[model samples]
Target: MNDDMRRLVRVQEIMVVIDALQEKIASNPAEVARLEKDLLAAQKDADADRARVSELSKDRRRLEMDLMGIESKISKYQSQLLEVKTNKEYQAMLHEIETCKTERAALDEKILLEMEESEKRSAALRSMEEMLERKRRETSQGKTRLDAEAQDLMRQVGALESERTEIMAGIAPAYLQPFIKVARQRKGLALVAVRDERCGGCHVRVMPKLIQQVRRATGLIACDSCKRFLYVPDEPSRAAGAGAESPAQ
Candidate 1:
């Protein structure tokens, strides 16, 4: 390849690398978002557990208060038993006392159950909080690593872009303009090597005459099918005469 062709190849190479780096850089935000989303989900779960623990605590307090009221009623009923005058009145007072004890026993059972559940839920909440803390730490570390990686990629792209600019300056407009136009049209692929008498970009058969012209390296020559500039490899065997066919238009 001539100097212009070599520069074009190098520029394409640099641009391809730059494109890949920029793509990775672009994806950094989405990766960060995904990490944050996971952390947020864990936080939400921890919050729900805390709310449940609070609710259980409230229920336990309410049950304890109800139990206290029942105990007071039982004490009042016992004191009234001493004031009864007749045996029939005494029996009625005893019945009231027995009814109060039954209600008190039921309340005690409910309070016990509530306290047990509260203990269990509180334990679960503690465990969830520990997990949330760990997740937060991991998310922070991951974000930092991604940020560092994106910054590194940006620096590499900046360097490659500078190299591409220098290479572009060395190339004349006649060659540079076509390369730019074709690279834009073909996603940064404006030049390809001829292999097996085929256009490397399109894989279409290349005319023998055009292959000869590409081997001569006289001027910029594009593939008829894909419009990408073609070149022959710097090998003696491959650069041998293709045929004496008429030159391509």
Candidate 2:
């Protein structure tokens, strides 16, 4: 390749790197968002579990208070039975005492059930909290790693931009403009090699005359199909040069 071709190739190489780096930088935010969303879900689940445990605790406490009140009432009724003036009143007080005892027993059973449920909920809450903490740590680490990677990619892009500028400075404006225009349209490939009578950029066959012009490298030789500037490799050109003195078969 001649000097211009070399410069163009260098520019394309730098652009490819720059494009990749820019794409990574653009995608960094989405990655961070996904991590944050995962962490948020974990936190919400932990909070819900904790709330359930709290509610069960309140129920257990209320049941305990109710049992204490029922016991006090039963004691009062039994003491009143001792002072009853007739068997009927004594029987009525006895019935009231039995009802209070039954209510206390029910409260005891309810308290036991509440305690069992609270235990289960507490265990679940602990598990959720641990999971949430792990998720938080993972999210934080992921964010840090992603941010560092994005910063590094940005730095690489900056360096590539500097290199591209220097390479572009060596080429004439007329040649550089067309390459830039085509590269923008073709995704960073402005020049292509002509191989096997085909345009490398579009993979379309080229005319014999176009291939000969590319071989000479005497002027800009664009592929008729893809409009990409075509060049023949230096090895083949040199080989052709070496055999130029041989008589044509």
lDDT for each candidate structure: 0.87, 0.82
Worst 10 residues of 2 by lDDT: 240-249
TM-score of 1: 0.91
| Per-prediction backbone clash count | 0, 0
Model 1 Cα lDDT, one tens digit per residue, 147-229: 99999999999999998898799887988998999999999999999999999899999999999888777689999999999
Residue ranges of candidate 1 with Cα displaced over 4 Å = 235-249
Q: Give the TM-score of candidate 2.
A: 0.90
CA deviation > 4 Å runs, candidate 2: 235-249
Candidate 2 residue 39 C-alpha distance from true site, Å: 0.7
| Candidate 1: 10-residue stretch with minimal lDDT | 238-247
Full-model lDDT, candidate 2? 0.82
For residue 145, give model 2's deviation from the true position in Å: 0.5
